[model samples]
Target: MTVRDDPRIAMLSVHTSPLDQPGTGDAGGMNVYVTELSQALARRGAQVEIFTRATSSAQPTKVEVAERVLVRHVAAGPFEGLDKNDLPGQLCAFTAGVLRAEARRAVGWYDVVHTHYWLSGQVGWLAADRWDVPLVHTMHTLARVKNAALAPGDAPEPLGRIIGEEQVVEEADALVANTDAEASDLVADYHADPARVHVVAPGVDLEVFSPGTLGRPALRAALGLPADDRIVLFAGRVQPLKAPDLLVRAMGVLAERGEAVPTLVVLGGASGRPTAVRELEALAYQVGVADRLVVRPPVGREVLAQYFRAADVVAVPSHNESFGLVAAEAQATGTPVVAAAVGGLRTIVEDGVSGVLVPDHDPRTWARALADLLGDDVRRAALAAGARRASARFGWDAAAEQMLKVYELAAQVRSAR
Candidate 1:
């Protein structure tokens, strides 16, 4: 797998757009990862084209996001948003469009095809077979892993997804995992070939998310947060797996104890179940901490940086995460995080170092951790100062270099086959 040449890559993200704002709709860390990594690859002299299902009628067929990185929007399904569960039926059409796009180019246009998510893997399989290229797949969150971590009152992942993901795991020429834990999940749960599985940790953009860019007190006042109250923020999609309600319930614990509860500021768009935010609102009312809760939609990266800087501590209470990008982003802004100690979060947030990690999903345990981090200014400040240093371990340039190695490995394997 050592012989190397200039590689042309076909990046497939079938269901979501890399241009979309993360933490909203169906876009999250996967979008940021693909967009940032592809840009990095392009900068490193790789010919990259990102293919996504066109969700709107107004989008141009091709957009040049960077100097050589192109986004080719291929129309496959209806021009309106459809549930992810119903996306499999459209993969055939997406695959046709991808092949047609490749047909317009020379025979050796794409040396490797990398797909994000299970839906794109289905299309990548067909395209890569037709193009005679290696297929590398990334499953951001495995269906089986997510189903096992379903929050209380949350619906389980569909059976169709579980079956599709299983097939993707079996068929991919190489699987790119965000962490060793995720790689283990593929090996143990789906029996993925250990030799073909590569654990390449994700990277954060230090340029966009850096420390000491904003004044915390002024930004908090601008965002309408109380100056004195502790602000425990959650900035991501509002879904059952994200467990925004758990943060609200933890606030309830502090409220019942007659302590000044940390204001749980949730900032993101409604996703997955339509009743996600409403369900959280209802639970907040039931817990009698509704007054301390604040929910807002997504914002630009600059404003998001402000929110991160203003926060006393960011809480990532997801049931599971392949990698917690928001935790990394927040840490890059010099804010400590209190995250659920599960999946890649275990690697992102070091206990008693950059941030505090809560072990159990129990509301009381989260309450205790949040209270301790919020109450102790000296310890919190120490974490805040060290947070940027922790985030320095991962940078997008390094990620792209590692991915180039994966591409070469996959290509060498394909050549052997």
Candidate 2:
């Protein structure tokens, strides 16, 4: 395989619009990653095109983000958004739209087809084979790893979504994992060729998430928190997998002992999975810490920054995250995080440095970690400062440069084939 001239890359994000609203089904991290990566790649002299389903009627057919980066909406299903589990049936139609659109292009065809999520891999695999382009897949979540880490209730039940994911891993030419854990899962569960898997971590926008700009006073007033109240926050989709109940249970433990319990703010929206709002509310009531819990819907990125800034500490107690983008965002905002030591969170937050990593599924441990951070001002300040320094390692510019290397490698492989 040899490197060649300027490459045109087609990024398949088939289920959700690359430019769609965040926190929606399959639209949070993957949407951010694809949109950010494509734009950054364009800035670095690559002709990039993002292909996604037209999930909204208001979505334009073609969106030009930069001179070299474009988002072309492929007609599939209807205007309403579909879950990734049901996306395979729509990929054939999406492929047809992509083929038609590319036929009218004046320049080079897609030298590399990069896919985000399993559904996109299904389409990319077919397109790569049909057009003789190299196929690169980014499995935002793996069914094998996710199924093993499922909450006690969600496990034991057959997950239809796992079937589609398995098909993608079995077919794709290359797998781009966000962490070593995901890379291990792909090889262990699906027997993917080890040579074809690449570990490329996700990146955060350092410019937007820089320090000292968050308006904490205004944000605290909006959330109705007292100036003196210690606030520990969790921000992400309000789904069962996110384990908001665990945070409520941990808060309950602090309340039971008559210790100083920090105000627990759960900021997120009802994205894909069944909303766990009632379960979280029930846990709060059962734990007798209803007054300490705050459940609010998603806020804008600026307000989100304020929440991150105002927090005494942030918590991400997910059962498992493929890549903990929230942890990175929190760290970027100079907020200390108390996350479960699992998945990509291991890489994002250094234990006892940027934040504390509690054992997964252990409410007592979570409570202790939360209590430790809330109790010690000096320690919290140190962690916060460390987070600011550590977050610089995940700059989007460096991430985009790494992706260019991957694209070039994929293009060289495609040319050889």
Candidate 3:
């Protein structure tokens, strides 16, 4: 707000571009976070530019996302999709591209470099050094944390990524976390200095995801969903860590018991690795619930809001989540969420209030919770009301305000150094 706090942020999201679509490829919450936060920061009077690896030749090298928020696609590796594990090998190339971009700008083009994920943090280290600025990093997901809670068939994270993240933890001038628990993880697991870690929660767009935009019947009709069917929606990547299979298993349970099952629609694309959709289909056939399960590709945000509005409840059964933005967006649309009690989801979904939190990842528990909520309109209505009220308290504007303070801290640290 003051001239002294006008941070010229050079955001680094090396592995995934903010211009990329969410719920597909490697672009999930982190991409949404960067895209929204940068725009919000720009609205609050900061000049921002995002730097990301160019994923394909079709995309232009430069794009203007907002009034003063520009996204620069730095050519690093081949202009094609590469596995996330292989991205580490391209760090030097990415760093070179970043420095080349900086060289083209004036000396004060960027006053501070803010990085998302460890891949970006790796690139941010060199950028911060070259620009003589502070580095603030957000580890959206920790390798060790995900490895410890791998889903049924999910592979453990490699040792190399763990080492890379540890180095980033050490090098970052300040670490930003989505929740207090995540902040504690940095201190306990990564040995981050307590004073250097800040807890800054991500936000949802109220203008787009607000409740009461459309009636459920009309919205479902627009999507061609059966009017008689009670829809249960799941929106995110189809990866095992997200536990899309868990939702399928719950549907199977409902069918086996001869109880009327709500139509389960899973909307998302494959993540880094192939999801278990095929295996889930086989399981659905084995359990006689194939007809009740539907899987569709991810939709745009506005269409996604319609899907959220059409649903009786949204399920988020992830094995691990940094903040569960999908859950928040759904809740903002007046849909109750049934999410796993993990990470920031604990705070996002108020157990027995806005939504129920199943402590364990068992399918039976999820099935019962879904069945009860679907059968009881009174309880679901209460939670739906609570969901809208609770979500109104947080938005992108609030997140941008908090991040400005974190930027000031990073700037202060740079001056001290």
Candidate 4:
């Protein structure tokens, strides 16, 4: 059987399950990336079996998330209360489960193994070596890249993670990056072989996140948001890396300037820390913009699209992102994004076109950008139109096609070795 003709894939996402809700605990864009990409590959005739650590006991051993796609929950340690930092210790147990599952099947059951994140890469390294299949890894976020742009009071990624990522980069037959910048980082920072690194941009679900039929005013009314008030939306985990606190401070800057402070709607939950969301609220209160701040839990994609449509502009002030999924999704919904100029976000948002790109995380700078964009309806409309066009460059089908090619290359590399 040819690689293009329905290759069976063993996909590993060790830290976060595809079925978990994003914007909460451990789950984020990486979860969405895996879930959506798997379905896209399945639609293209690939049979994908995703292995994720079981987070809850109630979860079945295997679940069919989409036709031709199965999510296998491997029990490694305690289902709950295991922090992400502790996951490295459970790699041996998780690897055992993956090998046992594949052992039950015939030899050569999986054509290739694709893993997301460094933790999964550790497991994939073993599984791929045992099965004699090519290993393809996507480092959703690199420890070095994140540590270089660490937010205030945020801890640097542990040394263990950095070592694990470097090892994975060395061993993997193919390394997938969400942007060219990331691919360059792999080569320059991690000293990865340039020939093995591939750039396959993650895609947005345009069908679910498209511009709706109703106008912003109508959408706001439907969402129970005040129609007359200007709205700025922040959708992601309330974590230091995401820089939601920067948005609150920007709101404070706007208020202090006696400008019309747009309601800053934060749509996400705490991540890493249990009190993250509450702390964000406290910051908003201290900034004297608490009344203008609204915190909402992250919702499903369909409902999230509604929230995107209801806002005048979407703010993505992340300190770093491998790929800014929220910015891409908002642009797909015809909402202009004001995102920080960092990592993949620099590629996702087009400055003065689809959205404005802030060069720094300064609250006053963000306030000025937000104020100027919100005050000018003509510019906002122009950007909204450009946002849709810019977002068109990314699609799941296109991403899947590119990924299939990468898989084929990985297979060839493994065979030659």
Which is the leading candidate under lDDT?
4
Instruction: Supply the TM-score for candidate 1.
Output: 0.96
Cα lDDT for residue 110, model 1? 84
Per residue, candidate 3 scores C-alpha lDDT tens digits across 1-417 of 112556788999988888878887788999899999999999988989899988888889899989989999888889875878789989999999889888888886788889999988989998898877889999999988888788987789889888989998888888999998898888998899899999988999987887866788898899988788878999988888998888888887888798888888989888756745677677778878889888888888899999999999999999999899999999999999999999989979998888999898998899899999999999999999999987986788999999888878877777777
Which residue pairs overlap in candidate 3's backbone? Answer: none
lDDT of 1 by residue, 288-401 (tens): 998888898888788888899999999999999999999999999999999999999999998888999899899999989998888899999999988878999899999989
Each candidate's TM vs. the true structure? Answer: 0.96, 0.92, 0.97, 0.99
The CA lDDT at 117 in model 1 is: 94
Q: For each candidate, C-alpha RMSD in Å?
A: 1.5, 2.4, 1.6, 1.0
Worst 10 residues of 2 by lDDT: 152-161
**TM-score for predicted model 3 compared with the true structure:** 0.97
The candidates, ranked best first by TM-score, are: 4, 3, 1, 2
Residue-level lDDT of model 2, residues 45-77, one tens digit each, is 778889988877887898998788899988888
lDDT score for residue 397 of model 3: 91
Q: Flag regions of model 4 displaced more than 4 Å.
A: 1-4
Q: Each candidate: how many clashes?
A: 0, 0, 0, 0
Best by TM-score: 4
How do the residues 230-313 of candidate 4 rate in per-residue lDDT, one tens digit apiece? 999999899999999999999899889898999989889999899999999999999899999999999999989999999999
